[model samples]
Target: MALIEIERVCRLFEDPKRGKPVIALDNVNVRVERNEFLCLLGPSGCGKSTLLNMIAGFDHPSSGTVKVGGHVVSEPGADRGVVFQQANLMPWLPVWENVAFHLKMTGAPKAERRERAQKFIDMVGLRGFENHYPSELSGGMNQRVGIARALLMNPEVILMDEPFGALDEQTKMDMHAELVRIWRESQSTIVFVTHSIEEALALGTHVAVMSARPGRIRELLPIDLDRPRDTTSAQFNDYKRHILHLLRPESEHRLEQAA
Candidate 1:
């Protein structure tokens, strides 16, 4: 069975302003294989985060189903780890404490938490900042702490909602490399939501593009490029062009019509 299965899922929210329910996702279907970096990409307001939330068990579908590791997702669980757009770290706590918060919550011993936290801290290139507070670190470093925390959980899947969206281009490039390395070393399954097509091309084994609001998966294109992919290569440009074509306004308008 696919490690993560989403079958004809739809999410409807009661829009208070309009006095009508807004459809966030319409009959969405996606299956994520184990240990693949699947990047969820589309224009803003396309419900990318909403779809990811279903997989992470942060929200439920109004209809159909979402399953991870062969179990229907009904509520948030430790089996799935999440890295949000913001670091979401407590300012009072040191980096080590933040990274091991899950263990602390579950009543694990301090020594074990520290050891495991150190391992992943090193994995994300944050080895020396263990004792520093979130306020003491740069945005990028704080983000690394967030990633370390998720890795320490050793979950079956990691859900990221545009984790690097706020960083500068160079920092984002660096983080992209760090993430790919960590993903390789840990062999973790990741479903990342991003609006940046270039970022998706840089990180994902497969890119799933969605239509505009009331989103539906428009295409799933596999990337077979070599590691440390060259963005300037002809094949890379071809893929970029194809994704651009898929997300164009005309195509999106057509998609909604067909739906």
Candidate 2:
């Protein structure tokens, strides 16, 4: 069975000012196999994050089902971890403490928490910074801490919402490489949401190109590019062009047709 299954899901929200319901997602179907890095790519307001939220069990679909490991997702569970755009780390706590906060909540002994958190901290390349507070770390380092926190849970899947969107270009690239390595080592499935075509191309094993709201998957393109992907290569450019064409507005297409 696919590790994650989203079958004909739909979500609607009440638009009081508009005096009607607004469709955010319509009949979205996606399947993610084990250990795949799937990027949900689309223009702004495409409901990518909404879809990610459903998988994280932060929200429910208005219709249809989202299943992880053959079980319906009804609420947040330890089987899935989420890393948001911001690290959202507690300012006062040091890196190790923040990464192991979940364990702390469960009443695990401090020594046990430290031991367990170290593996993920090392995995995310934050070993030397374990005692540093969030205020002492850079944006990218804090994001790494967030990733380490998620990994410490040893979840089957990790859901991310544009975690690198706020970083500088250089830092973002560095993080991408680190993330790919960590993903390979951990063997965890990931569903990432982003609007950048290059970012999607750089990271995803499969890119799920989505239409503007009400969002639907236009195509799920398998990214066959080799690791440490060459963004300037002809094949990479070809994929980018195809995704851009897929994301073009319907009205623009209609204009071309008229021309």
Candidate 3:
């Protein structure tokens, strides 16, 4: 069974000055399976992040519903963790404290929170930098803190919105491997959003290609590639070609017309 389901979801933003509304998503429907690494891929302004926000309970859909583990998602909870494009770590807090902030809010003791946060901090390869502030860390390191913070919640579902988009290509590749390792270790269902076809293929077991405006699912392609994916291999290029075709404007238009 699907771990998360979105049925006929739609989101519209009102343009008060223009006396019209902007359609962000149109009847978007999809299902995510348990421990599945699902990537929502599309062109810019395709409402990929918007859809993610709805699933994270940061925003509500104008129509339809989002369910996680068979429970309707009505508000943000500890069960679902979100890592945004920016690290969003608190400037005032050190790495360990930031990682355990959610626990701190729930009244978890200082020592317990420190112990739990350290485990994930080490998991993300920031072993000795636990006491460093966000400003002291590099971009990639800061992102690791964000990931570690989210994992501390032991969330059933982890939502990532292009979390590595801001990094350099080299850093991004490193983060990709780290993310795969973390996912394997944590066994958490991850719903990641990215514009890079290669990034999606590298991380996701299933890639959901979305359309341009008034976003809708153009295709739900299953990627059967092996772990520690080889981007330079023939099979990888073949799969990338297939996904690239599906993301083309004309291809999306034809599919929409057919539907």
Candidate 4:
């Protein structure tokens, strides 16, 4: 079975000011297989984050179902981990402590927490900075800490919503490489939401291209390129062009389709 299944999901929000129910997602269907890095790619307000949130069980669909491991998702569970755009680390705690905070909440012994947190901290390349506070690290490093925290949970799936969006270009690129390595080592499924075409191309095994608000999956494209992708290559650019074409205004896209 697919590790994650989103079947004909729809989400509607009551827009009090507009006096209407706004459709955020309409009959969205997507499935993520085990260990696949799937990027939800589209413009802002495309319901990418909404989809991720549903998978994480932070929100529920207005209709249809979201299932993980063949069980319906109802509320937040430890089986799924989440890393948000912001690290959201506790400012006062050191890195290791922050990464192991979940364990701490469960009354785990400190030594056990330290050992488990160290494994993931090292996995994320933050071994030497375990004692540093969030304030002491760069934006990218803090994000690594957040990733490590999620990894420490040893969840089957990790949900990320534009975790690298705030980083500088160089830092984001570095994190992308690190994340790919971590994903391979951990063998965890990931569903990432991002607006950047290049970022989706760089990280995803498959890219789910979404339409504008009242979002729907336009296409799910397998990224058959080799790892450490060459962004300038013709094939890579071809994929980018196709995604851009899919993302064009609906009228323009239909015109091309009819041509």
Candidate 5:
């Protein structure tokens, strides 16, 4: 059975100027199985984030169903953990405290919170830095803290909205490797949202590409590459070419040579 299911979901937002609801998504459906690393890929404004938001329970679909682990998602729950582009850590809290913030919220004892957070802190490779404040950590390390926090929840599903989008290229690549390793070890399903084709190809077991505005699933392609994927490989390029075609307009692609 699928771990996360989205069926005929659609979202509409009010347009202040137009005084009417604007369609953000229309009749979209996708399913993620347990332990699958699924990437939601598309251009900006295509509602990939919107779709992810629905699964995260940050927003509700105007119509249709979103079920995770067989229960319909109505609001944020501990079963799903979300990591956004920013780490959103508490500046004053040290790494472990920040990672175990959810525990604190639930009134878990300090000793247990520290103990539990330590396991995932080590999992994300931030073991020794457990006492360092977020301000003291690098962008990548802070993001690790954010990831550790989510993993500490031990959620059935992890939702990442371009979590590595703000990092430098080298750091992003390193984090990608760490994430894939962590995913394998943890055996948790992940739904990562990103506009980067290369990033999706590197991490996803399957890439679900969304169409332009009023977004719908344009395609769902399984990635068959080995770990530490080589973007230069012919198979990689073939997938890239196909995805690029799906994302860009024919006229704009033609203009690439002229420029």
Candidate 6:
């Protein structure tokens, strides 16, 4: 059975001025296997983030459903952890406290929370900075804190919505490697949203290409490239070309017409 399943999910926004609802996702369907790294890639304004939000239970679909671990998701829970485009950390708290914020919410002991946070802090390469505040960190370092925070939850799936979008290219690449290593070591399923094709190709075991507004899934491509993927390899380029073609306007028009 799939670890996460999005079945014919659709999200619509009602605009009173337009006298009609705006469709965000149109009959989107996807199944994610356990331990799989799935990337949702598309143009800006596409429903990729919307879909991720639905899976995270931060939002609901207008039609259909999202199921994880054979349970229908109705609200946000510990089973799913989310990392947003911005690293939304508490400015007043130190790194370890921020990482263990969830545990703190449930009234975990101070020393226990600190110990749990340290494990993930080290996992994300943020060991020595546990006592530092968010303001004391760089963008990349803050993002690492965000990642460690999510890992500390030990959720079944980690949903990342452009978590690395704000970083420098070099820093983003470094984070991608760190993320893959973490994913492997933690054995957690992940659903990532991104606009960068290279980022998707570099990190995903499977890439789901999504359409523009009134968003719908266009294609689901599997990446069989070896680990520590060679981005410059011919096979990688071939897959990139395939993905580029799927994201092209003409391809979208064809799919819309077919629908």
Best by TM-score: 4
Q: Residue 96 error for model 4, in Å?
A: 0.5
Q: What is the alpha-carbon RMSD of candidate 2 to the true structure?
A: 1.1
Error of 6 at 75 (Å): 0.3
Greater TM-score among 2 and 5 belongs to 2
Q: C-alpha displacement of 155 in model 1, angstroms?
A: 0.3
Worst 10 residues of 2 by lDDT: 248-257
TM-score of 5: 0.95
Clashing pairs in 1: none
Model 1 Cα lDDT, one tens digit per residue, 34-91: 9999999999999999999999888999999999989999999888999999999999
What C-alpha lDDT values do all the predictions have? 0.93, 0.96, 0.94, 0.95, 0.94, 0.93
Candidates in order: C-alpha RMSD to true structure: 2.4, 1.1, 2.3, 0.8, 3.1, 2.2
Model 3 spans > 4 angstroms off: 251-259
For 1-259, candidate 5 gives per-residue lDDT tens digits of: 7999999999999999998999999999999999999999998998999999999999999999999989999999999999999999999999999999999999999999999999999999987898999889999999999999999988999999999988999999999999999999999999999999999999999999888888989889999999889989999999999998878764676699689
Off by over 4 Å in 5: 250-259
Query: In model 6, where do residues sit more than 4 Å from their true spots?
Result: 251-259
lDDT of 6: 0.93
Write down the TM-score of every candidate. Answer: 0.95, 0.98, 0.95, 0.98, 0.95, 0.96
The per-prediction tally of clashing pairs is 0, 0, 0, 0, 0, 0
Tell me the deviation in Å of residue 132 in model 5.
0.6
* Per-residue C-alpha lDDT of model 4 across residues 53-161, encoded as one tens digit per residue: 9999999999999999999999999999999999999999999999999999999999999998999999999878989999999999999999999998889999999
lDDT of 3 by residue, 1-259 (tens): 6999999999999999989999999999999998999999999999999999988998999999999989888999888999999999999999999999998999999999999999999999999999999999999999999999999899999999999999999999999999999998999999999999999989999999998888999899899899889999898999889878777787666788899
The C-alpha local distance difference test score for the whole of candidate 2 amounts to 0.96
Residue 84 lDDT in model 6? 91
Q: Which lDDT value does model 4 have at 88?
A: 99
